[model samples]
Target: MENDCSRFVQKCHKCQIHGDLIKVPPTEPNAMMSPWPFAAWGMYFIGPIEPDASNKHCFILVTKDYFTKWVEVASYSSVTKKVVTDFVRNNIICQFGIPESIITDNGANLNSHLMKEMCAQFQITHQNSTAY
Candidate 1:
């Protein structure tokens, strides 16, 4: 019975399409080591969530330092390239100093031309993760 169920699931096209996506490499992933605090950072966007009353914030930008695990979050009503770049500039670069590298998912806002120019201007390496 278990074998039959497993075979059925493996052959189901809808199950494959709607299945949970794997975000990691099939083999062991290489560990990233940060040389110092605030040296490497990871950024992510969460939302279009239910808006709040205070500022009608529906989106959140979150960043974390690789070494220290220090997190910074900002709320926005709409996410755009300009919003993302300004967040990196004012919150990350200005407050914490330039980072060695930034890791982010390949979203349009994060991968925009303006974002590329900003990183080039600051000499910060930007890395995009494989889409899950």
Candidate 2:
């Protein structure tokens, strides 16, 4: 039975390329449309910035100015509503004033009504990035 199974496996094309395959490109590579990167003067990415450490909590909330290459990083505890709000309040609103548009990851906390309300109150456009 083992000898028969081995003979059957050897006949399979998928198994034949054990290590001799080179550059087996996708057949339908151009069938999918590639996406262009989003352009925004001021953008923010609200997500986990660093690994969870024993003592320190780190979340990545980055605000970047496209023209100036200026970036602001907001560190928080996980991706919670309070932390996101605090990031906007302390890092965004207080430091660089109000941006025309605010970009954040499509996390649950970031997509909440409270976050929307905050953006509305501040007259800032809130844009969410698509998950790759």
Candidate 3:
């Protein structure tokens, strides 16, 4: 009887169309772990914000240490590869020492040749976030 009911449901077009949807994840979720403070950092750009007292500032570059949750931020008029590389060199590297790796979104400025060269010079691993 149970097998007959199962077969009946399987053969029912309306049941197949209107049945409860099964939710399956596309991929397994992995947690990011950092061994120590400033070991791994994530960097991203924010805005075309309203200019503040510093008139030249339009965009903000933000970096956060994965382990300690420490944040470093700087403002710039325009964001280029040079600006990003300089920020990583001056603010993050100089202030906290060299990080093992840096993660960033798939922005052209972050993934440019110049930025990659700069990271290579510092022996820091650069990784891009996966698109959803």
Candidate 4:
């Protein structure tokens, strides 16, 4: 086993190796995208909470107005596509009409197909933050 592992390591190394370990270059950004100008507007952030005793998930939907710093929050249990869809449709959109966009953490529920469809139906732009 030890000999096999050494051979594997040798296979990974090439001539003219200068350092004690190998280094990899960072990945480049997507070429298809361009810089975006920040605009002052209202935005929503949605995310799930800790699981309860019954293993059910809780979701919080928060909205903040960029100019005034006004905020609002709504909670739900399931966090399913339908639940989140209905919540955004009725509570957020219906109350304030449509905002410039909605920002959300990269949760699975927020990235589902049904959520995308709902956003398309309401003509709302949805943006998700990348992992830090």
Candidate 5:
């Protein structure tokens, strides 16, 4: 039994490799193509910064269009799902028209029920980021 196992390891190409162990599957490069402006957007939160702004706001919510690199920003004391939804509704949808997709990190405020419902209503694809 021991000899068979030893022979199997010797014949295995991966076992012969002298480098860092690869636990995850090798990933192929994927091109993220946005067909047009306002087609895709990515959202992020800046900080609960020292309330430096004139409005005494501490948090900054910013979203940028993937194609045009156009950005929309707003500041608030605290960020909630309501705040996120309102920002998307007013800044992105109302101003630039509905986007094809919105991608955000898997934040609670970003991936709320309200956001999903809004996306469904607008026919916008909402995706939470995954480790890639």
Candidate 6:
């Protein structure tokens, strides 16, 4: 039966390792509660996407304001601590004013000293999200 084959494959280490890769993207998390609009934001990065754009950008940086559900996005060839800091400075702070807090995953680029220093200088609380 189909079920029996699936079980047998699961038990076979070679089959499991050599099986067709799962192409489905994982589910995304929803925005959490924020005290006020532009007061808090969530930041994350998306890929090394296929067929680079004319500008050669293959990655995207995204941020969502928790309360307003407003999103800001930019494409980049590469993402670095300075790039993230500038994104927060020019896109978030300059456009909306200083936020009370910002949330990001524990990515090295996101949590780098540059980001930490910028947040500390601006007095913005930085929080890391844990995968559920």
Which portions of model 5 show Cα errors greater than 4 Å? 1-30
Clash pairs of candidate 3?
none
Q: Which window of 10 residues has the lowest lDDT sum in candidate 6?
A: 24-33
TM-score of candidate 2 to 2 decimals: 0.56
Tell me the tens digit of each residue's lDDT in model 3 across 1-132: 999999999999999999877774577777766888899999999988875545778889999999999999888888899999888988999999999999999999989998889889989999998864
lDDT, candidate 4, 1-132, per-residue tens = 999977766777552365354566767975522123222223344445565425463666665655455566667665566766676677666776665566666777677798788778767678886765
Q: Which residue pairs clash in candidate 1? A: none
**TM-score of every candidate:** 0.74, 0.56, 0.72, 0.52, 0.73, 0.75
Best by lDDT: 6
Candidates 2 and 3, the one with greater lDDT: 3
Off by over 4 Å in 1: 1-30
- Give candidate 6's total backbone clashes: 0
**Per-residue lDDT for 1-132 in model 1, tens only?**
999988998999998888777974588777866899998999989998874648899899999999999999999988999999999999999999999999999899999999899999999999997888
Worst 10 residues of 1 by lDDT: 24-33
Listed per model in order, the count of residue pairs whose N, CA or C atoms clash below 3 Å is 0, 1, 0, 0, 0, 0
Model 5 score (lDDT): 0.90
Candidate 1 lDDT score relative to the true structure: 0.92
Candidate 2 contains a number of clashing pairs equal to 1
Instruction: Please report how far candidate 4 places residue 89 from its true position, in Å.
Output: 1.0
Against the hidden true structure, what lDDT does model 3 obtain? 0.89
- lDDT against the true structure, per candidate, is 0.92, 0.66, 0.89, 0.61, 0.90, 0.94
How big is the positional error of residue 53 in model 1, measured in Å on the Cα after superposition?
4.0
- Residue pairs of candidate 4 with colliding backbone atoms: none
Better of 2 and 6 by lDDT: 6
Query: What is the Å distance of residue 84 in model 4 from its true position?
Result: 1.6
